[model samples]
Target: MNIIDKALNIFAPGIAAKREQARTEVVRQQAVRKVTNSLIGGVGSNGRGYGKHGASTTKSSMLFWKTPVGDADTDIHQNVPKLRERARDLHMGSDIVAAAHKGLRTNIVGTGLRLNPAFDASYLGLTKEHAETLRSSIQREWALWADTTKCDAAGLNDFYELQGLAFISTLMSGDVFALMPSKPRPWSVYDLKVNLIEADRCATPPDKVNIDRERIQSGVEVDADGMVVAYHFSNRHPGAGGYSLSGSNEWVRVNKYGKRTGRVNVLHLFEAERPGQRRGIPVIAPIIESLKQLSQYTNAELAAAVITSMYTVFITTPADDEGGTPFDGVGMDDEDLDGAEDVPGATGDEIKLGQGAIMRTDPGEDVKFADPTRPNPNYEAFVRAMLKQIAAALELPYEILTKQFTSSYSASRGALLEAWKMYRMRRAWLSKTFCQPIYEEWFVEAVSKGRIDAPGIFDDPAIFAAYTKAEWHGPSQGLLDPTKEVQAAVMRMDNNLSTGTRETAEINGGSWEDNVQQRAYEQTRLKKLGLVQAAPTVVTPSEPSNEGDEDNDDEEGGEQN
Candidate 1:
């Protein structure tokens, strides 16, 4: 501070200020650099950073890190095809996947689709006789399309098969299409045919399809409101081997409705994941990684078990003049070991030991058998935990998924009840999105063909909708304790908590009206045969006497005494 400060003050009076300003500038630049770095590279609160390209400093960064979060329709357009392939592969390869599909199909579709027509008697102002006639006529007309041989050229047989196929398709692929064709068939009341189109045929729009004006994205054409207007399907499946004369992939445009009348002709069946979602994502998409890992784990366990079952022998031989051959002195024709000849000989110094074989070892040589322990002790517990997670992801109960009920009755029942909620939701979705629409279309055809009599069908949309109102019945949720469940159902009905129609449908998958009609028919037949049916016994509780009367009787008796 003595000589240098004195010289700086003499040479430059502003030297101190200049040095201070330089230091301040350096700090300011540092602050600016820090801010700029922060702006350019997104610094997270946890001290982890992400670069411009979304390359993160976090250890868990994945390839999909930069993948933008898109809406449902966008997600489907980008990922659904790959998801479909993966899901199909899983369904084919994984037992769990197959079981899930089978369970869903069985629970949702069951034996067949039963129609319960709920026509409003008062609204239509129809007499009892007229309603009966209309219902009977509708049923008869439905039978034509319900038959598998009459419905489609594929010989699907009935709507049950159609339902099962459609459900499976929707699960495997993102969507399924049902084309309503006007083909004259001898068996059908209306010249209606249903053809199921797979997702493969609905590829990206071809060059001539005009993706701009048509607003076609991923094979589906949408209007300004984002409603699907048409579907552009390849004439043949992309995987199918065929040649078009035009030397290009031929595509056909199928409108959602008939061009002339604006009547619906195509039914697209898929559960919408978003409001404007054009397609669906496979149900198995979320659990694919878990499934693959599970498959690998299962295979490894099986292989380990197989390895553990085999006996491994280790041989040690003393140094010998014959180059360490253990069977040097063992005679080939020795009768003591008759089956020793069957054991193949090893080359050079190699010793091959098999079951029921003797090896002549050099005097001090030892032969020990290895007892291998495999299939890790924690394997079952790990698998069970993993399965629980997988089941949760699929919205299924682990017991149902595994078909193993090791829990108590109450626990199992609780799991089933919880699982049924999901199943019921899916069933309702399927019914609404697929079955109801198809039924409404069928109703329209039946009314138009004069097969079923309904006034004001075309003029009044409300009446048309009312006429199409119907309920679909599937398999019943059978009782765990039949007597108790039946009694409970009866009590509910008696207390007006439920109805006979609902109870009948829940228990037997039969319409209450149909059951009543069948009962009446049976009664008529019995009466015709002069057989008396047993009447139901009614038990009434006895009334209690008044307490005052009992006291009065006792007092009178005492006075008389």
Candidate 2:
């Protein structure tokens, strides 16, 4: 070997290694530069450019900025109609939605209308003898007006059912309107009828008369003080047939009917979500996306189950037996195109494909079946979580919403108690907004017509307030453990923590005075029938004896022995 050839070969390997290292270094430097540029340029790690002012660059993030911002009512005014329509559709289409409404109605108003007269009899200048007479008189007059036969045009059972319907309407629509109009009756002391108006009937007045001063928007006219002065109602409901965009659909301006003392006659029932929100958003608005997703998930699960049940059977035949029937001796028929016919060896009855009928194949043919597994294991857990979120958004307990109580007793009771708090608050709001106004108007009419004997009814504001004071009773939330609850109530009363009046009012939603009167009447009837209920007697405990007294007693016993 030549020495020069050997040296050249050894150096060639080293030169190749150096070139490879240099190339790698260049690539590494380029990568570092690119990463540095991205970091300094406010770009996301994913290579998407940053939004303006370093916001997220994704389309979803940018879409949030497009949301409108303004006063609550103004922002939602145009969308209210659409929201109501969607909410109604959801309520009708979804079982859970319907169940929710039904449960709320049952809890809020059960059985019938029960408003107890709690008027201050002494303040009205009536003696005890006259007080009972006056209360009964007022109650009878209220019954006359509140009876379904006299009050509602649509023939609901009574005012109680009307209240329930109003609640449902308010939930479906953003709000509901009730118009109190007087009618004439020969035998009645006062003729007051309640007309329920759909939200569609009230709209921005078409005439637009003095819009600058009236500030009329969405059928409601508000004054400088932000109080509703009048309501512009379409002659017919906007949703009614024959509605047109022409000037033919005239708006009737009904001056806000109320007393001179700032009590409104037109009752609008809705729960406001914001400080300046003039109109309500549907209860379902906040959870609509979740509801849609849940519905889709449910439908997908059902579809999967159906697909899994569909078993496909395949029959293989010999290469040369294309014209032969799979069933051995059965011949092909022109009439049985879909292959629904009795086979030769089978019973004479027709065999349907999906009705668990046995299939007969040729001796050498192979039968293969396809069965699909469906309904993912995570489906139920995922659905349950989604329903919980929906219940939260609706201000209801999950158990209450789904009507499934697999929870512990304590947990279930806690949920029920918490739900009752919200229910009570809503009930109070409904009564204040809807029931009280109607009662006040009725009171004024009854006093004017001399049906109720309240002296100085018009002169003094204090008299008006005292005479109009009433307590509305709804269905009782019966105790889960009646014995324990009754004992606790008795203890509370004995300890002066609560009064009989309050306890009576809480238990059955009845007035204490009314209950006492009813009990007295029962006792009178029992006396007439010579049947007496034994009164319960309380025995006081004796004090413990001292040790000396016991010894003395022992000695006396020994002496006697």
CA RMSD of each candidate after superposition: 11.5, 14.5
* TM-score of every model versus the real structure: 0.78, 0.74
Candidate 1 per-residue lDDT, tens place, 1-561, comes to: 567657777898699667668879999998887787777654542344443235554446544455677766566677888888899999999998999888878877877657778788778788999988888888777877875557764665577688888888888887888887778866456666678999878765557445574377778887887777888888777656774524667778889977798878788888776776677777788889899899999998897676445455666776678466554445443543444322245553344333456555555678888776675888888888898898888888887888775555555566778888987887787788777877887787787787778889788878877788887777776776565567778878878999887788788887787888999999999999999977955433334423233334444322211
Q: Give me candidate 1's TM-score against the actual structure.
A: 0.78
Model 2, 157-239: lDDT tens digits are 46777888888888888799888888875664567767788887888764574466336767778888887788878877767
The lDDT of each candidate is 0.74, 0.72
Off by over 4 Å in 1: 1-67, 71-74, 208-214, 242-248, 316-366, 524-532, 537-561
Top lDDT hit: 1
